[model samples]
Target: MQDKTTLYSLRKTIGILGLALPILLLVTHQDLLSSMSHYYYTAGGVFFILILSAFGLILLNYRGYPKQEGESFSDRLITTVAGICILVTVLIPTKSENPLGTLFFTDYPYLFGHESNGFLGAIHLLSAASFFFLLGYMSFYKFVLNHDASASKNRLFRRSGIIVWASVGALIIIFAIEKILKINMDEVFPAYTFWLEWVAVYAFAVAWLVKGKIHKDFEKMIKTFQTEKSLKKH
Candidate 1:
Protein backbone atom coordinates (compact mmCIF):
# COMPACT_ATOMS: atom_id res chain seq x y z
CA MET A 1 0.00 0.00 0.00
CA GLN A 2 2.79 2.38 0.91
CA ASP A 3 4.62 1.52 -2.29
CA LYS A 4 1.51 2.16 -4.31
CA THR A 5 1.10 5.55 -2.68
CA THR A 6 4.68 6.41 -3.47
CA LEU A 7 4.25 5.48 -7.12
CA TYR A 8 1.10 7.55 -7.38
CA SER A 9 2.90 10.52 -5.87
CA LEU A 10 5.73 10.12 -8.29
CA ARG A 11 3.35 9.97 -11.22
CA LYS A 12 1.64 13.09 -10.01
CA THR A 13 4.96 14.87 -9.79
CA ILE A 14 5.94 13.86 -13.29
CA GLY A 15 2.58 14.98 -14.64
CA ILE A 16 2.88 18.35 -12.92
CA LEU A 17 6.31 18.87 -14.38
CA GLY A 18 5.14 18.02 -17.87
CA LEU A 19 2.19 20.36 -17.62
CA ALA A 20 4.22 23.20 -16.16
CA LEU A 21 7.21 22.94 -18.47
CA PRO A 22 5.91 24.99 -21.38
CA ILE A 23 4.17 27.54 -19.22
CA LEU A 24 7.26 27.96 -17.10
CA LEU A 25 9.41 28.48 -20.16
CA LEU A 26 7.02 31.02 -21.63
CA VAL A 27 6.76 32.96 -18.40
CA THR A 28 10.42 32.95 -17.49
CA HIS A 29 11.85 33.66 -20.90
CA GLN A 30 8.84 35.55 -22.27
CA ASP A 31 9.72 34.29 -25.72
CA LEU A 32 8.38 31.44 -27.72
CA LEU A 33 11.07 29.51 -29.54
CA SER A 34 10.57 27.57 -32.74
CA SER A 35 10.42 24.36 -30.69
CA MET A 36 10.54 23.37 -27.06
CA SER A 37 14.02 21.96 -27.70
CA HIS A 38 15.06 25.40 -28.89
CA TYR A 39 14.40 26.68 -25.41
CA TYR A 40 17.84 25.29 -24.64
CA TYR A 41 19.16 28.54 -26.15
CA THR A 42 16.99 30.78 -23.99
CA ALA A 43 17.02 31.79 -20.33
CA GLY A 44 14.66 28.90 -19.76
CA GLY A 45 17.56 26.69 -20.71
CA VAL A 46 18.18 25.98 -17.05
CA PHE A 47 14.58 24.93 -16.53
CA PHE A 48 14.64 22.85 -19.68
CA ILE A 49 17.80 21.02 -18.63
CA LEU A 50 16.95 20.66 -14.95
CA ILE A 51 13.38 19.44 -15.44
CA LEU A 52 14.41 16.92 -18.09
CA SER A 53 17.34 15.76 -15.98
CA ALA A 54 14.98 15.28 -13.05
CA PHE A 55 12.71 13.26 -15.30
CA GLY A 56 15.65 11.05 -16.31
CA LEU A 57 16.66 10.46 -12.71
CA ILE A 58 13.11 9.73 -11.57
CA LEU A 59 12.41 7.31 -14.40
CA LEU A 60 15.77 5.65 -13.90
CA ASN A 61 14.94 5.08 -10.24
CA TYR A 62 11.32 4.16 -10.88
CA ARG A 63 10.59 0.52 -10.06
CA GLY A 64 7.06 0.59 -11.50
CA TYR A 65 4.58 -2.22 -10.83
CA PRO A 66 5.87 -5.70 -10.29
CA LYS A 67 6.24 -7.81 -13.39
CA GLN A 68 3.56 -10.35 -14.11
CA GLU A 69 4.15 -13.76 -15.65
CA GLY A 70 4.97 -13.78 -19.38
CA GLU A 71 5.63 -10.06 -19.36
CA SER A 72 8.67 -9.52 -21.60
CA PHE A 73 9.67 -5.96 -20.75
CA SER A 74 8.81 -4.54 -17.36
CA ASP A 75 7.68 -0.96 -16.84
CA ARG A 76 10.97 -0.19 -15.16
CA LEU A 77 12.93 -1.16 -18.25
CA ILE A 78 10.80 0.92 -20.61
CA THR A 79 10.92 3.90 -18.31
CA THR A 80 14.67 3.53 -17.89
CA VAL A 81 15.13 3.62 -21.64
CA ALA A 82 12.87 6.62 -21.89
CA GLY A 83 14.88 8.30 -19.15
CA ILE A 84 18.13 7.68 -20.94
CA CYS A 85 16.78 9.03 -24.20
CA ILE A 86 15.43 12.18 -22.57
CA LEU A 87 18.83 12.79 -21.00
CA VAL A 88 20.42 12.43 -24.40
CA THR A 89 18.02 15.00 -25.81
CA VAL A 90 19.09 17.39 -23.10
CA LEU A 91 22.84 16.72 -23.23
CA ILE A 92 22.92 17.00 -27.01
CA PRO A 93 21.34 20.28 -27.94
CA THR A 94 19.22 20.55 -31.06
CA LYS A 95 20.20 22.59 -34.14
CA SER A 96 19.77 26.15 -32.97
CA GLU A 97 19.25 28.29 -36.07
CA ASN A 98 17.93 31.27 -34.10
CA PRO A 99 19.18 31.52 -30.54
CA LEU A 100 16.94 33.61 -28.26
CA GLY A 101 19.48 34.34 -25.56
CA THR A 102 23.20 34.32 -24.95
CA LEU A 103 24.34 31.28 -26.93
CA PHE A 104 25.43 29.11 -24.08
CA PHE A 105 27.77 26.30 -25.08
CA THR A 106 27.21 26.97 -28.79
CA ASP A 107 30.98 26.62 -28.95
CA TYR A 108 31.69 23.64 -26.73
CA PRO A 109 34.89 21.77 -27.57
CA TYR A 110 33.60 18.99 -29.80
CA LEU A 111 29.94 18.60 -28.88
CA PHE A 112 28.31 21.85 -30.00
CA GLY A 113 27.17 23.76 -33.13
CA HIS A 114 25.23 22.17 -35.96
CA GLU A 115 27.94 23.13 -38.45
CA SER A 116 30.71 21.64 -36.31
CA ASN A 117 28.75 18.67 -34.91
CA GLY A 118 25.80 17.87 -37.12
CA PHE A 119 25.91 14.25 -35.95
CA LEU A 120 25.26 15.36 -32.40
CA GLY A 121 22.16 17.22 -33.58
CA ALA A 122 21.01 14.08 -35.32
CA ILE A 123 21.46 12.13 -32.10
CA HIS A 124 19.43 14.74 -30.23
CA LEU A 125 16.60 14.52 -32.74
CA LEU A 126 16.61 10.72 -32.71
CA SER A 127 16.72 10.55 -28.93
CA ALA A 128 13.89 13.05 -28.64
CA ALA A 129 11.79 11.09 -31.11
CA SER A 130 12.39 7.83 -29.25
CA PHE A 131 11.62 9.46 -25.94
CA PHE A 132 8.23 10.78 -27.08
CA PHE A 133 7.34 7.53 -28.83
CA LEU A 134 7.97 5.60 -25.64
CA LEU A 135 5.89 8.06 -23.68
CA GLY A 136 2.96 7.60 -26.06
CA TYR A 137 3.37 3.83 -25.93
CA MET A 138 3.36 3.80 -22.16
CA SER A 139 0.32 6.05 -21.94
CA PHE A 140 -1.59 4.11 -24.58
CA TYR A 141 -0.68 0.49 -23.83
CA LYS A 142 0.86 0.08 -20.40
CA PHE A 143 -1.39 2.48 -18.54
CA VAL A 144 -4.53 0.82 -19.83
CA LEU A 145 -3.27 -2.66 -19.00
CA ASN A 146 -5.48 -4.82 -16.79
CA HIS A 147 -8.23 -2.18 -16.95
CA ASP A 148 -11.62 -2.51 -18.56
CA ALA A 149 -11.80 -0.86 -21.96
CA SER A 150 -15.11 0.61 -20.99
CA ALA A 151 -13.69 2.26 -17.93
CA SER A 152 -13.71 6.08 -18.08
CA LYS A 153 -10.09 6.33 -17.00
CA ASN A 154 -9.07 3.86 -19.67
CA ARG A 155 -10.93 5.87 -22.27
CA LEU A 156 -9.19 9.03 -21.12
CA PHE A 157 -5.84 7.28 -21.32
CA ARG A 158 -6.50 6.13 -24.86
CA ARG A 159 -7.60 9.57 -25.95
CA SER A 160 -4.53 11.17 -24.47
CA GLY A 161 -2.36 8.56 -26.13
CA ILE A 162 -3.97 9.24 -29.48
CA ILE A 163 -3.36 12.96 -29.07
CA VAL A 164 0.29 12.33 -28.28
CA TRP A 165 0.71 10.05 -31.28
CA ALA A 166 -1.12 12.46 -33.56
CA SER A 167 1.02 15.34 -32.43
CA VAL A 168 4.11 13.31 -33.19
CA GLY A 169 2.77 12.46 -36.63
CA ALA A 170 1.99 16.08 -37.36
CA LEU A 171 5.52 17.06 -36.35
CA ILE A 172 6.99 14.45 -38.67
CA ILE A 173 4.84 15.55 -41.58
CA ILE A 174 5.79 19.16 -41.00
CA PHE A 175 9.46 18.26 -40.92
CA ALA A 176 9.22 16.29 -44.13
CA ILE A 177 7.37 19.03 -45.97
CA GLU A 178 9.80 21.68 -44.82
CA LYS A 179 12.78 19.58 -45.79
CA ILE A 180 11.44 18.66 -49.22
CA LEU A 181 9.88 21.96 -50.19
CA LYS A 182 12.42 24.11 -48.36
CA ILE A 183 9.65 26.17 -46.82
CA ASN A 184 9.36 26.97 -43.17
CA MET A 185 5.86 26.46 -41.80
CA ASP A 186 6.72 28.61 -38.83
CA GLU A 187 6.88 31.49 -41.28
CA VAL A 188 3.08 31.46 -41.45
CA PHE A 189 2.03 29.39 -38.44
CA PRO A 190 4.45 31.06 -36.05
CA ALA A 191 5.93 28.55 -33.62
CA TYR A 192 3.99 25.57 -34.89
CA THR A 193 6.62 23.21 -33.56
CA PHE A 194 6.33 24.65 -30.10
CA TRP A 195 2.55 24.37 -30.17
CA LEU A 196 2.58 20.76 -31.34
CA GLU A 197 5.19 19.82 -28.79
CA TRP A 198 3.14 21.52 -26.10
CA VAL A 199 0.09 19.48 -27.04
CA ALA A 200 2.02 16.21 -26.89
CA VAL A 201 3.57 17.09 -23.55
CA TYR A 202 0.22 18.07 -22.07
CA ALA A 203 -1.43 14.93 -23.37
CA PHE A 204 1.21 12.82 -21.67
CA ALA A 205 0.72 14.86 -18.55
CA VAL A 206 -3.03 14.28 -18.50
CA ALA A 207 -2.68 10.52 -18.84
CA TRP A 208 -0.17 10.27 -16.02
CA LEU A 209 -2.17 12.59 -13.82
CA VAL A 210 -5.24 10.41 -14.30
CA LYS A 211 -3.21 7.29 -13.66
CA GLY A 212 -2.01 8.85 -10.43
CA LYS A 213 -5.67 9.28 -9.41
CA ILE A 214 -4.88 12.91 -8.79
CA HIS A 215 -8.55 13.81 -8.63
CA LYS A 216 -9.13 11.48 -5.70
CA ASP A 217 -5.99 12.75 -4.02
CA PHE A 218 -7.20 16.31 -4.34
CA GLU A 219 -10.59 15.34 -2.93
CA LYS A 220 -8.96 13.67 0.02
CA MET A 221 -6.79 16.68 0.66
CA ILE A 222 -9.81 18.94 0.60
CA LYS A 223 -11.71 16.70 3.01
CA THR A 224 -8.76 16.59 5.36
CA PHE A 225 -8.59 20.34 5.40
CA GLN A 226 -12.32 20.63 6.02
CA THR A 227 -12.16 18.11 8.85
CA GLU A 228 -9.32 20.03 10.47
CA LYS A 229 -11.30 23.25 10.22
CA SER A 230 -14.38 21.61 11.79
CA LEU A 231 -12.28 20.22 14.62
CA LYS A 232 -10.83 23.62 15.33
CA LYS A 233 -14.30 25.17 15.40
CA HIS A 234 -15.59 22.50 17.74
Candidate 2:
Protein backbone atom coordinates (compact mmCIF):
# COMPACT_ATOMS: atom_id res chain seq x y z
CA MET A 1 0.00 0.00 0.00
CA GLN A 2 1.14 3.55 -0.66
CA ASP A 3 2.08 5.52 2.46
CA LYS A 4 -0.11 8.26 3.93
CA THR A 5 2.45 10.93 3.07
CA THR A 6 2.43 10.01 -0.61
CA LEU A 7 -1.34 9.94 -0.78
CA TYR A 8 -1.58 13.29 0.95
CA SER A 9 1.06 14.72 -1.33
CA LEU A 10 -1.03 13.80 -4.36
CA ARG A 11 -4.16 15.30 -2.84
CA LYS A 12 -2.27 18.40 -1.85
CA THR A 13 -1.01 18.90 -5.38
CA ILE A 14 -4.51 18.62 -6.78
CA GLY A 15 -5.87 21.07 -4.19
CA ILE A 16 -3.11 23.56 -4.91
CA LEU A 17 -3.74 23.26 -8.63
CA GLY A 18 -7.41 23.98 -8.00
CA LEU A 19 -6.50 27.01 -5.94
CA ALA A 20 -3.82 28.29 -8.32
CA LEU A 21 -5.72 27.83 -11.55
CA PRO A 22 -7.77 31.01 -11.17
CA ILE A 23 -4.68 32.96 -10.22
CA LEU A 24 -3.21 31.82 -13.50
CA LEU A 25 -6.34 33.16 -15.15
CA LEU A 26 -5.59 36.48 -13.47
CA VAL A 27 -2.30 36.78 -15.38
CA THR A 28 -3.91 36.83 -18.80
CA HIS A 29 -4.28 40.67 -18.62
CA GLN A 30 -6.73 40.83 -21.45
CA ASP A 31 -8.83 43.96 -21.90
CA LEU A 32 -12.14 42.19 -21.42
CA LEU A 33 -12.89 38.97 -19.58
CA SER A 34 -16.42 39.40 -20.81
CA SER A 35 -15.10 39.69 -24.31
CA MET A 36 -12.10 37.38 -24.29
CA SER A 37 -13.87 34.92 -21.97
CA HIS A 38 -11.17 33.19 -19.95
CA TYR A 39 -8.45 33.85 -22.52
CA TYR A 40 -10.42 31.95 -25.16
CA TYR A 41 -11.31 28.25 -25.40
CA THR A 42 -8.04 27.76 -27.24
CA ALA A 43 -5.92 28.67 -24.21
CA GLY A 44 -4.50 25.30 -23.20
CA GLY A 45 -3.66 26.29 -19.65
CA VAL A 46 -7.17 27.49 -18.92
CA PHE A 47 -8.68 24.44 -20.53
CA PHE A 48 -6.38 22.17 -18.57
CA ILE A 49 -7.31 23.93 -15.35
CA LEU A 50 -11.00 23.27 -15.94
CA ILE A 51 -10.37 19.59 -16.60
CA LEU A 52 -8.18 19.36 -13.52
CA SER A 53 -10.81 21.06 -11.41
CA ALA A 54 -13.58 18.81 -12.70
CA PHE A 55 -11.50 15.71 -12.04
CA GLY A 56 -10.56 16.97 -8.62
CA LEU A 57 -14.23 17.43 -7.79
CA ILE A 58 -14.85 13.91 -8.95
CA LEU A 59 -12.11 12.73 -6.64
CA LEU A 60 -13.70 14.65 -3.83
CA ASN A 61 -17.07 13.09 -4.58
CA TYR A 62 -15.63 9.63 -4.28
CA ARG A 63 -14.15 10.55 -0.92
CA GLY A 64 -17.39 12.12 0.35
CA TYR A 65 -19.70 9.17 0.72
CA PRO A 66 -20.23 8.76 4.44
CA LYS A 67 -21.88 5.85 6.28
CA GLN A 68 -24.25 8.30 7.90
CA GLU A 69 -28.02 8.08 8.04
CA GLY A 70 -30.08 9.98 5.43
CA GLU A 71 -27.09 11.72 3.81
CA SER A 72 -26.21 9.34 1.02
CA PHE A 73 -28.83 10.01 -1.65
CA SER A 74 -28.80 13.80 -1.31
CA ASP A 75 -25.03 14.00 -1.14
CA ARG A 76 -24.65 11.78 -4.16
CA LEU A 77 -27.20 13.74 -6.14
CA ILE A 78 -25.62 17.08 -5.28
CA THR A 79 -22.16 15.84 -6.11
CA THR A 80 -23.39 14.41 -9.37
CA VAL A 81 -25.03 17.69 -10.31
CA ALA A 82 -21.95 19.65 -9.34
CA GLY A 83 -19.70 17.35 -11.36
CA ILE A 84 -21.97 17.68 -14.38
CA CYS A 85 -21.91 21.43 -14.03
CA ILE A 86 -18.15 21.43 -13.96
CA LEU A 87 -18.00 19.20 -17.02
CA VAL A 88 -20.39 21.37 -18.98
CA THR A 89 -18.61 24.45 -17.72
CA VAL A 90 -15.42 23.13 -19.30
CA LEU A 91 -16.96 21.89 -22.54
CA ILE A 92 -18.89 25.10 -23.16
CA PRO A 93 -16.58 27.86 -24.24
CA THR A 94 -17.06 31.12 -22.39
CA LYS A 95 -16.86 33.12 -25.58
CA SER A 96 -15.47 32.65 -29.04
CA GLU A 97 -12.64 34.70 -30.52
CA ASN A 98 -12.56 36.60 -33.77
CA PRO A 99 -11.22 34.59 -36.69
CA LEU A 100 -9.13 37.62 -37.63
CA GLY A 101 -7.78 37.98 -34.09
CA THR A 102 -5.08 36.29 -32.03
CA LEU A 103 -7.27 33.32 -31.11
CA PHE A 104 -8.19 32.65 -34.71
CA PHE A 105 -6.43 29.30 -34.53
CA THR A 106 -9.22 28.06 -32.22
CA ASP A 107 -11.40 28.16 -35.36
CA TYR A 108 -14.55 28.91 -33.31
CA PRO A 109 -16.72 31.60 -34.76
CA TYR A 110 -15.83 35.03 -33.41
CA LEU A 111 -17.99 36.41 -30.65
CA PHE A 112 -16.96 39.97 -29.97
CA GLY A 113 -18.74 40.43 -26.65
CA HIS A 114 -21.24 38.93 -24.22
CA GLU A 115 -24.01 39.93 -26.57
CA SER A 116 -22.15 38.27 -29.36
CA ASN A 117 -21.84 35.07 -27.38
CA GLY A 118 -25.60 35.20 -26.70
CA PHE A 119 -27.14 31.88 -25.71
CA LEU A 120 -23.83 30.06 -25.38
CA GLY A 121 -22.45 32.54 -22.88
CA ALA A 122 -25.67 32.34 -20.93
CA ILE A 123 -25.37 28.59 -20.63
CA HIS A 124 -21.71 28.91 -19.67
CA LEU A 125 -22.59 31.43 -16.99
CA LEU A 126 -25.33 29.18 -15.64
CA SER A 127 -23.00 26.21 -15.45
CA ALA A 128 -20.29 28.22 -13.74
CA ALA A 129 -22.77 29.61 -11.24
CA SER A 130 -24.20 26.18 -10.49
CA PHE A 131 -20.73 24.76 -9.99
CA PHE A 132 -19.68 27.39 -7.47
CA PHE A 133 -22.94 27.60 -5.57
CA LEU A 134 -23.30 23.84 -5.28
CA LEU A 135 -19.73 23.40 -4.09
CA GLY A 136 -20.21 26.12 -1.51
CA TYR A 137 -23.45 24.56 -0.34
CA MET A 138 -21.82 21.16 -0.01
CA SER A 139 -18.97 22.63 1.97
CA PHE A 140 -21.11 24.60 4.34
CA TYR A 141 -23.71 21.93 4.96
CA LYS A 142 -22.59 18.42 4.07
CA PHE A 143 -18.85 18.05 4.42
CA VAL A 144 -17.85 16.81 7.87
CA LEU A 145 -21.44 16.83 9.03
CA ASN A 146 -21.25 13.11 9.47
CA HIS A 147 -17.54 12.45 9.63
CA ASP A 148 -16.63 11.93 13.27
CA ALA A 149 -13.40 13.85 13.54
CA SER A 150 -11.53 15.68 16.26
CA ALA A 151 -12.53 19.16 17.39
CA SER A 152 -9.69 20.87 15.59
CA LYS A 153 -10.43 19.12 12.33
CA ASN A 154 -14.09 20.03 12.53
CA ARG A 155 -13.10 23.63 13.17
CA LEU A 156 -10.95 23.59 10.07
CA PHE A 157 -13.87 22.29 8.04
CA ARG A 158 -16.13 24.95 9.49
CA ARG A 159 -13.76 27.78 8.65
CA SER A 160 -13.25 26.49 5.13
CA GLY A 161 -16.98 26.24 4.68
CA ILE A 162 -17.43 29.81 5.82
CA ILE A 163 -14.88 31.01 3.30
CA VAL A 164 -16.56 29.08 0.51
CA TRP A 165 -19.99 30.51 1.27
CA ALA A 166 -18.57 33.98 1.78
CA SER A 167 -17.12 33.92 -1.69
CA VAL A 168 -20.50 33.02 -3.14
CA GLY A 169 -22.08 35.92 -1.30
CA ALA A 170 -19.42 38.30 -2.49
CA LEU A 171 -19.92 37.27 -6.08
CA ILE A 172 -23.63 37.80 -5.77
CA ILE A 173 -23.13 41.25 -4.29
CA ILE A 174 -20.61 42.23 -6.94
CA PHE A 175 -22.87 41.22 -9.77
CA ALA A 176 -25.88 42.83 -8.16
CA ILE A 177 -24.04 46.11 -7.75
CA GLU A 178 -22.75 46.01 -11.29
CA LYS A 179 -26.20 45.38 -12.70
CA ILE A 180 -27.96 47.84 -10.43
CA LEU A 181 -25.54 50.61 -11.21
CA LYS A 182 -25.17 49.70 -14.87
CA ILE A 183 -21.36 49.73 -14.63
CA ASN A 184 -18.84 47.22 -15.82
CA MET A 185 -17.36 44.90 -13.19
CA ASP A 186 -13.86 45.90 -14.31
CA GLU A 187 -14.52 49.57 -13.63
CA VAL A 188 -15.52 48.74 -10.05
CA PHE A 189 -12.82 46.23 -9.19
CA PRO A 190 -9.09 46.06 -9.77
CA ALA A 191 -8.96 42.57 -11.28
CA TYR A 192 -12.45 42.75 -12.72
CA THR A 193 -14.07 40.20 -10.42
CA PHE A 194 -11.23 37.76 -10.96
CA TRP A 195 -10.33 37.95 -7.28
CA LEU A 196 -13.94 37.28 -6.39
CA GLU A 197 -13.89 34.23 -8.60
CA TRP A 198 -10.54 33.22 -7.15
CA VAL A 199 -11.83 33.23 -3.58
CA ALA A 200 -14.69 30.88 -4.53
CA VAL A 201 -12.38 28.48 -6.35
CA TYR A 202 -9.83 28.64 -3.55
CA ALA A 203 -12.53 27.96 -1.01
CA PHE A 204 -13.67 24.99 -3.04
CA ALA A 205 -10.09 23.74 -3.22
CA VAL A 206 -9.35 24.35 0.44
CA ALA A 207 -12.45 22.64 1.85
CA TRP A 208 -11.51 19.47 0.00
CA LEU A 209 -7.92 19.71 1.18
CA VAL A 210 -9.09 19.96 4.74
CA LYS A 211 -11.44 17.03 4.29
CA GLY A 212 -8.60 14.97 2.79
CA LYS A 213 -6.10 16.12 5.42
CA ILE A 214 -3.80 17.00 2.59
CA HIS A 215 -1.83 19.56 4.56
CA LYS A 216 -1.24 17.35 7.60
CA ASP A 217 2.30 16.41 8.51
CA PHE A 218 1.94 12.71 7.83
CA GLU A 219 5.35 11.40 8.89
CA LYS A 220 4.05 9.61 11.96
CA MET A 221 1.05 8.31 10.07
CA ILE A 222 3.21 7.08 7.22
CA LYS A 223 5.58 5.33 9.56
CA THR A 224 2.70 3.57 11.29
CA PHE A 225 1.23 2.44 7.99
CA GLN A 226 4.63 1.15 6.83
CA THR A 227 5.13 -0.81 10.07
CA GLU A 228 1.73 -2.44 9.70
CA LYS A 229 2.42 -3.28 6.03
CA SER A 230 5.78 -4.95 6.87
CA LEU A 231 4.10 -7.05 9.59
CA LYS A 232 1.46 -8.20 7.10
CA LYS A 233 4.22 -9.33 4.67
CA HIS A 234 5.39 -11.94 7.17
Q: How does residue 189 of candidate 2 score in lDDT?
A: 59
Tell me how far the alpha carbon of residue 183 in candidate 1 is from the true structure, in angstroms, after superposition: 0.7
On lDDT, the candidate that comes out on top is: 1
TM-score of 1: 0.89
Give the per-residue lDDT digits (tens) of candidate 2, residues 10-73.
4465567777675454454333343323554435435444655555465445444434666544
lDDT of 1 by residue, 132-172 (tens): 88888888878888544348888888888889989989989
Candidate 2: Cα lDDT at 222 = 89
User: Model 1 RMSD to the real structure?
Assistant: 2.8
* Colliding pairs, model 2: none
Global CA lDDT of candidate 1, please? 0.82
Candidate 2 lDDT (Cα, whole model)?
0.60
Q: Which regions of candidate 2 fall more than 4 Å away from where they truly are?
A: 1-14, 26-37, 41-53, 56-63, 70-73, 96-115, 216-234
Error of 1 at 4 (Å): 0.8
lDDT of 1 at 192: 88
